[model samples]
Structures are given as structure tokens and as C-alpha cells.
Target: MEFPPLPLFTEVELKSEIARVATFKKVPKGETLIRQGQYLKVLPIVVSGAIRVFQTFEDREILLYYVRANETCIMSLTACLFNNESASYAITDAPTQVLYIPSDYITDWQTRYPSWNKFILAAYRNRYDELLHEFTDAVFKKMDERVLDYLRNYRDTHSVHTIPISHQALALELGTTRVVISRILKSFELEGLIGLHRGSITLKKPF
Candidate 1:
């Protein structure tokens, strides 16, 4: 079995153990990795591509964060640590390859492997900062500003000016209605900020 180049797994013993037990998978875009209220049996680490973590309340879903290459979800780590059901679901944001380590191994490796402990602590810190930023933005920023920031950040992350997403999908991520997102996007188009194409939005030249 081939393993992705992960810095944390550089130790010979840990790498060998991971290779012996951990399972690897290539997940297609939009596929569900974890579901809310489900007990996690494995902790997923992204090898390539991205996973979008979100929470659903009633009919709406709010984006929590994205787990990119070489990263693991802190929520998943917490679930593994406490042996609790997941509060949010995760879905592949793009075609993704992931390494899934069994929950039992997670706690066992913490004291056994120094690198593993360091990785877990770093993941926790990074995710906490992200969650704080998300809360701050939701509380202080206007919806339009949030939308624009999302677009710019997405463009920068993906290195694509044309974002292939529907207004409804965008609204779900921003915790708003499709109509509101459409209205805001339309206003952006009118202001020469973006170009609205069929099922996609393209950032303008100066953007």
C-alpha cells in the first residue's frame, strides 16, 4: 500500500503501524465522509483534495471549515478522543484521497508516538482559530461582505476565477436562503465585480 507524504508519519514504527492497519480510499466529490449523530470508527486524514465540514440545523447547513491536504478534522479527532457521536457531517469538496486510521489507534498512538501527539495538538489549535474566525465573521460581518470574502478566499485557495457552484449551494454554506445569495450575487454582477454564468460565478479581472 502507498502512503501519502505525511510529515507526522515519518517515524519508522508509526509508518509501519499505519501501513499495517490504516485504510486508504479515494472519495469522489460530494460523497459523505461522516454523518451527524454517528459514532466515528475511523479518523480521516486528507492526503489530497478537500473535505468540507458543516453542521445542519433544521433545513439549513452552516459551513464549519475545510480539511485540506495533509490535514485532519479536529472534530473527528475530538470524537475519537471522547468516543462520542459526531455533531457535524463531512463531505468531499473535491475528488479526495484520504487515509483512515481506526479510532482505537488514535489514543494509543498519542503517548506512543511523539509526532502523532504534536500533530493532534497542532490540528486542535488550527481548527480552534478557524472556528473563532467563523464565529467572529458570522457575528460582525454583513452577509454581502461574508459572501464576497467567501468567494475571494475560495478563489485564492482553489486558484480558479470561475467558481462552479449554484446559488443554493452557496447559500447553504453561508447559512442563508438562495434568494438572498442570488440577490447579492446579482448586485455584484451589476457592479462589475463578477460575471454570472450558467451554474457558475466568475470573478472579474480586478478581483
Candidate 2:
């Protein structure tokens, strides 16, 4: 089913507005759209491909979340609206097509374009709710259970019974130590619940 261009505009208008937005750009795999600890100037919307958002402390970079096409990458509504610095890094997982929007342009569009305004506001709220859910899960769940839930959820979305996330990345995503993640994965492997290999794990059966 087709969604009306986020609510106030015709489909053609929405496409035209976005087209007039800013020049589209291509990013290669492993390149950063925005880096943590740096000042954010522009926010990017993913036109195609995927991006991984992460946070770094000293030498360790913790995985935060993933974004696919049609999702905003820079978290501008949060960082810019609150006048705070960015808290994560956004890096492409594959070669990506994106529209880079200037900060002032977004601010102006919010006043001039009703559909754009509504869409951006909704994206902000949805992302806020998602973070809240993640925080709740972290507070109430055990590490192993969280890991299991994460793997199951990831598998479902990726449409692959196997997941190729690295152990260290999984540790960061689950907010646990790598050793803890390793032990739990080993337990699951021993029970024939999954098959583990270099930098990947495959579910033996559906969750």
C-alpha cells in the first residue's frame, strides 16, 4: 500500500521537494556519514542501502542501531533541536545513496513545508520511543536473554536464518562483555540451537 507523502502534500510535491532539497551523494561501504565527537553540520536521509550507528569510548566502539533506506541518518531533530552534540557515529554498511540536507534548509522547510515538518517530527518521536524501549530492555533483562532476543529480532528483519554480526559487535549491542557473549553463544551452540563460525552465527531453527 502507498503511504501519502507523509500527510499534507501530493506524491509529486513530496518528490519535488525532496529533489530540490540538496544534491544527492554516494558513500562507499565503511565510510562515515557522521562521526561521534564531531560537530554535526548536515543530516542525511538514506535513499538506498544501510547504515550502522555506533558510539565510541576510548578504543571501543559500541553498536547503537541500524538504519535502512527511507530512514534519516544524522539524528538532527535531537542534536540540533536540543543544541547538543551528537552521541553516535553513522557509517554505511554498503555503498549508499543519500540526500545531504543543510541545517538551515531543514529549519526553513519545517516552516514552509507541512508534510516535511510532520514527517521529521514523527521520525524524531519514533526514534525516541525506540530508545526508551531499548533502555527498558537493558534495565530488566539478563545479558544472555537480551542477546538471544537481539539475535532473533535481527534474524527476522534480515530474512536470513543466519546472522553475520561479529562477537564483539554483539557484545556492544547487548551491552555486555565479549566473554559473556562468547559463553552464551557457546552454550547455544552446544545445545544445537545455533551454529557458530568465524564472524557469523546461524540459527538452527526459527525462534
The top-ranked prediction according to lDDT is 1
For residues 11-84, write the lDDT of model 2, one tens digit per residue. 56656765565668778989977766666666777767788888888888777677777778545446755556
Task: Name model 2 segments beyond 4 Å from true.
Answer: 1-14, 77-85
Once superposed on the true structure, which residue ranges of model 1 sit more than 4 Å away at CA?
A: none
lDDT of 1 by residue, 4-95 (tens): 66676668899889988999999999999999998998999999999999998886787888999889998888888898999889999999
Local error of candidate 1 at 79, Å? 2.0
- How close is every model to the real structure, measured as TM-score? 0.93, 0.83
